[model samples]
Target: MIDVKQPPYSAVGDGVTDDTQAIQNAINAAQAGEVIMLSSGKYLCGPLVGRSDRPLLLTGTVGAQIIAKPNTRTLLTIRCSASNVFQLEFVGAALTSVQPFLASSCIRVNDGLSGVVIQECKVSQFSGAAIIANASISLRVMNCDMSTGQLCVQAARARNIVLERNTFHDLGQSGFALHGDGIIIRDNVCYRAGPVGGFGAVQAGSKNILITGNHSTDGGGGFELQNENALSATEPSGSSCVVAGNSFTRTFAAGIDLFRSGVVLTGNVFNDCNFAAGLPTAFTVQPGIVPDLAGPGSGYQAGDILTLGGGVFTRPARFVLNAPSPNGGLCDPARPATNGNTYVIDMGDYSVFPTNPANVTGGHGTGGKVIYTNANIKARGSGYKSGDVLRGSTGTSRFPVLVRVNIIDANGAVLEAEILFGGYYTGTLPTEMAFAAYDTVSSGSGFTLLPCFGNRYAMQYSKPSMASGGSILGIGNRNVIVSGNSIVNHSPSHDCGILFVNFLNAPVSRWAITGNVFGTFSKGAIKRYNFGTLSYDTAWGAG
Candidate 1:
């Protein structure tokens, strides 16, 4: 271990003298894996850089602090891999009024560094993020106390990052803003953080992420999933993630604002959350699909084949089948149909048609052939207006579906759908679909909306008396299991214990909401709009 106070490169830790060059010299001279120790006094320093080849350990005794001088952007920048910074206090100039350096950070890890650990440190009084990292891998930060910063930690394009057992308070923005994949945030506590924009204490967008055992009190919210980097299309943002075993209390916004896909939430608690009177909901789920407002256009007829287009990300083509016709011999004698019958057979509850016409045969009968001739609107896409024209694919196509919009709703949603041409489609539906004058591309990238497919177990919500929102609110989510939850002591003016709203009229299928207990809700235990294909059982009231 090399001590900074005793040597030819002596660092004067007197709280007033400039120790920038002395500290830099000690760090430069340290060999690989050697410990550079600092005693208990304050060391005034400007910007310092860690050696790339050394990977040295920087440690400090109790009450040891490195104070940033005026006009310093970053106190220390680490470019080395596998470096360790432990038990130090990073004080910035924002604590004082005169000559305060507002835009400063305590530490910054350069891009592509890996296996860096920062533990048991105190960081405070900076306008920018206390710790900033980009494009790093395997970074771990634990047992730290951070306060009085715009943000505690901000990371982007990083992977396999773990932040655990940290305490954050009095921040202007979120405690953590993380992006990329394989992130684990656990056992962190936040109080009075995320006040500026009402972002969650832990706001992240990543794939394969796990956020658990955290606590947030009197803050903006508990957790949110939103992409911080919009330009990176290849990165996974909020897909295949899990949020479980967290606590959120007395928050201004929802306890959890979930906007991504393929997420599982369970074993969490929201107590008195959404207490701010104007906020609508405690736990909110918003969909990412945008639909066109104008009605399906006028020029398309019943049998036309239309191609789908203009989504944020590319998806597999889907179509809805209608107006079935019977051909050949009768397949089922119980359900008799003539050869010219055009009425659609009741094909159970399935809405989407198979891609191949051969799969459309023998639903109610064995030998009778059923052909679906009419193509209809399965989903009305967004960003369309009245008078916009929709056309099918070109080139080797025989007849293309043609349509022009004529009517729209107050919010520009399509209300009337008319087909202008009855075109013939064979084999399978074409994969190309486009619109003229109504195509709007997605504004941001790294967002793809998939169905929610997971199990929720034993969550608790209690005492949101200041707002008129549901304890749990979901919009446009599917394939979820909500079981063994308890919602108690809600305000009488609130809507319901749980509420779901589906504006797009998409199929809300495969949802199992069961074994939930509710108490003293004004509306009921649960309420929904445009709900589709659900199993609701084993639910009761406590009082």
Candidate 2:
């Protein structure tokens, strides 16, 4: 457990007036966890100091106030040798020291440290970082309002840090600088900190992090994974990071910017941010000499499918889906879906198609009883010579019959027919029957039944199956349904069409694709990969 009591030499600072000297006296004599209790009053001070030799606790009454003079250094400076805790009401205290020669910070944890914990403090108005955790390990900062500083918390070279349930406001730099490894920053509200030309730049190059459930607004670039080229000489390997369920809106740039790899960006919201032209990507893989990875060639491999559900992107920007489909990259037979969510793609591209198409001449259509059946069946207006073999049958002949079918009469009065039937034979006897509409004898006369013309119609069992490539169905293993719950609008300036099953390069096995509406006003809808296992069959009818 914690050694909660101070050494015998520890002193107390009566907080009735200028408590700076009394607090310093306590710090000089005491070991860690020594409580410098303050009596209830207004204590004017430049900075209240503590040590990391052991843990220190500073306590005061509920109404006690420790006010720092303006333009002074940090209210509290945490050094490399001490791991202390400050429990007090700090008011108007600039956390950092102002003199250029002196170190300034509300709380500065210097390099080569092992552990420190800062909890349950109300610290505000530090000119520099409220809490600067530099090159340490296991820094646990929880339940603090670190506001009105140039940089709230500058975390560098730390590992296994937990920054939870803190509120940040009106800062200059990032809400929290995550330059450490294996950090968890969750359930924090950071607002109105950095939004100027040189405001709130996020820390660069840290790895194995999990950042989730945080809300940020009005900050310049919500969070960035900055890997400056100079610092990459000592480049920390950045991978296996997960950013999920965070919201970024009303920011100048990306919500969560990425400059590393193996980051699973799932279930986040990027809403109404100034992500217009030339803003950094919310998720970007920087260009470097490709590493010799074991499985995949590039950062993105084939057959890597993703499901984008339960998020919102309220700008007219591209939300990229990285699989191969027809025409674009969506060529897999396993049809994927964009459904079951209330996220709006108000004006952007949503179709996924592959880049190439494949050819297979050996696959023939399912044929009927004839030698070969073409798609065009009605031979009346189609070119057919006399004695053309419509269908072949071995049975004996039945007597011929006559019939007539037409859309209008020569007299122009609407023609009506009673019952007309013929050509009922059995035993595989192929017969042909054709009829035109019965014509009127004179103008506007009642229609009369004309003699059967020499027209020929074939009754046969031979019909070729339609090409499966053109068939888009959402049923069975395909599970493709375009329900009426979506609206897809494509601009006309760009050429577009829907090419299904572009995923042959990265084949899909089974899929449940339902409730997506695609509009192709200009550009194509779907494109599939050229050489992948992408097979897509749609059972749902297209709208």
Candidate 3:
């Protein structure tokens, strides 16, 4: 161990003098497994590069300061094996610049390095990331205070990296973002990670990542695990990730926004997420969907239901499948939709049925489902669980259909369903053409009108839409689980808390839910489609 102040180099840390060459000389003379120490006072310098074979260890006294000048890339570059940097307070040269490019990070562990440990370091006023690990392994960054950078830590294509007990405040981007494998961001605190947009405070797009025991406040949102399947190429699809024991408060939108599948999000807390416009839930289990809306054929509008039996029905519903499919996250459309076989598909609310069943227009016997009217939902407004069967009244298509009650928003609106098809589109033989009911029904027919003659609330609320109405909807998704969190809205705007819908008429299963609470939403707490097992582990709704 050689001290820079004691060597023949005799470096000065007067907080003003240029100490760049003095420190570089010590690093050059030191042998493998050597230590270079910087005593109290600021050493103003440019980039300090580390060695490969020597495995250098750089330490500073309690008040030692490294005021780094600006460079195109990082101020401290470590392209070596087993390099450790600790106890150094790095302030950008621009902040306090003996040097210019204050645009990069304090330290950058480059590719092909292993076993790097950086602890107890404080960095401020850099334009880019505080610490970045690219193609490095076993990189442990603990007990660091990083602020005012593009990103606190950006780790890409790395393995076995652990970031613990770090405080990232007011960062321009995410606190910790990873695009690699085996990364764990635990026991960290982030405040206002992304001041704008719906980005996550801790965003991951890799495999085997665990984000546990972290606390976030007033950020873009919390942990978002995504599998981005773009049109041209596919990025790394996150799989087998776990987010547990995390707490989030006052996020702009969601607390934990999930865009991938096969994740276990357990024992987390969330509050005040003004869920994006119509979609709800601080934690959403929404699968991505895409429309081939180009070239010769135009895309379908909101209520255009195309059935396999060469028929198209449009019964407008507030249906929006907001998640765009990842590169490989789509299954083939409703199969066996062969030509010449007539079919009628129903895209209605998940729980409440329509008010009239006799409204189905064109009924051909050898074909598919018969579109029911608001009358059908009016009769079954009590509620329907997933897989429960429902029968139309004698006046209408007296078919037995199965259904499931998937979603119930805060407004007490239920989805309309037939019992036999298990909440799916059913086909009945062509019998009667009830075109008048399908084409001439009045708007908001699904809502059960409240006879509030005085009209204390808004006119919209007096007539609450329910069953097969505009306010309630479902997109055909099968298996999903949104459990164990308090998804609420404290904002004065009355936004929804959780909104999960499916556009593709599909079936899913294997759901797990438990220990959850919800309340204080502007509109409603939960808005979902009747797709999977709707089980409640704990009591929810405004407590």
Candidate 4:
């Protein structure tokens, strides 16, 4: 063992002196597998970089701290495989403002390093993440205490990382942001972590992940699994993850929010979660879309149907163009139709459109005819499934009245429909009787081919005073197994114990809900909106 205070290169342990060069010399001279020890005193240091070949162990006695100098981006950077750091406290400027430390961190492990271990360390008052591992494999962080930071740990593009037995509290943002594959997070405790609109205590967007046996209290939310990149992509951003045996209490938002696919949730417990009245339920699967705030692209005449692109799980929305008026003439002053501003007359049954301006036709008043018209379900047709295509008989071969089915009731009656290609027809449009299946639209881009599954979850005492929302809510999930679960004692104003909703005409189907215990909810035990092919033992109550 090489002691930093007792060597040829002596490091001052006093809190005021800079011991950066001394400690760095010791680290550089130390051989592989040797120990570099620091005795209980404050060592003010700048950034320290470790070698990849000479793997060393850095440990400290009680009350030993490494204080970062002002304006330090990262205090320690490790690129060595099998390096271990233990029992050292990392202290930062504790700046209240996040601007100075947005890119700063206490410790960072570079990419492609493996077998790095950080244990029994305490990190506090950093404006950014305490520990960041980028593409590092087999990294382990255990028994650490982290508090008062933007985030505790961020492992991105990494693999086989294990975070166990850690304690996080009072974070400005989330405790952990894990975006990788083969991650394991177990037995962690978080309190008062995650800010509003942030991804809860733990935000996981990884495949083959296991988040089990964690406890969270009074956080923004317990956990969130969102693969925002998966939207409009051919492959899911996250898949084959399991979140089980976790407990969450008094969360501001949902206890668990799933916006990814192929996740299996089981044996999770939620209590008094979703305290924010207008938020989602204890468990939710609400997929959201981020639209380009800028107005739809320029050019095009009245009645042009355009398909948008970009974004994950992007819904297919048909933007029907409206006649554009000149800026100064025949238009209200407040809402003038300026040059290059194309007005969308209708956004049919979808929320997000593409942001790429090149997809739009330019130069207004091309004199393209407007043939877009609303196709209503004049009569509720039976024996039709959601996503079924219907064609109008009055339409010519080129212009077929193509409508996509949106929602269907339990009795197989079509409840809603969206126009896919509203063909031009001179005669009156045909009714439901004249409609028949022509061809199904390609389930691409906006559809989630893989769905989330939930089984044996326990939810109770969620949103005690809230007049809306359910105990467990899901959207666009498929083949769910909600069996052997117990839901009880929800607020009287609560909507239901379990609720499932569809998104943008995508069907929620193949749910097997059996052997679940439900008690006193205001609306019912289970409710569904645009659901399909559900198998339940008991009748679902009113919503």
Candidate topping lDDT: 4
Name the lDDT value of residue 105 in candidate 4: 84
- In order of appearance, the predictions have TM-scores of 0.58, 0.46, 0.57, 0.61
Best by TM-score: 4
lDDT at 193 for candidate 2? 49
Local accuracy of candidate 3 as per-residue lDDT tens digits, 186-268 = 89988755422223423335777788898887654566555442111122554457778888876543566444445566777
The sequence of per-residue lDDT tens digits that candidate 4 reaches over residues 1-543 is: 999998697999897999999999998889877999999999999998887677868999999999988778799999788999999999875332111223458999888889999999999756568998888899999999996435688888888989999998756556787777787889999876643322342333567778889988766567766543322111244356677787777655556654444556677666665544443322211111111212323344455455433323223423444443333111112221111122232223322222322133223423222111122234565777765766654322223434445566786565554433323222222322256666654321111111111100111112222224444555555645555455554445445666655533444566666666666665676766442333221344542
Residue runs of model 3 more than 4 Å from their true location after superposition: 95-102, 197-205, 228-239, 275-481, 492-494, 501-511, 529-543
| Clashes per candidate (backbone, < 3 Å) | 17, 90, 57, 6
Q: Give the better candidate number (2 or 4) by TM-score.
A: 4
lDDT for every model? 0.54, 0.39, 0.49, 0.57
Please identify model 1 stretches exceeding 4 Å from their true place: 95-102, 197-205, 227-239, 278-467, 471-475, 485-493, 497-511, 516-519, 525-543
lDDT of 2 at 108: 64
RMSD after Cα superposition, model 4:
22.1
TM-score of 4: 0.61
C-alpha RMSD by candidate, in order? 21.7, 31.4, 22.1, 22.1
Off by over 4 Å in 4: 96-101, 197-205, 227-239, 278-467, 470-473, 483-493, 514-519, 529-543
Clashing residue pairs found in predicted model 4 = 231-312, 231-313, 232-312, 232-313, 299-362, 299-363
Q: After TM-score superposition, what is the CA distance of residue 376 in candidate 3 from its true location, in Å?
A: 62
**What is the Å distance of residue 98 in model 2 from its true position?**
16
Clashes of 3: 57
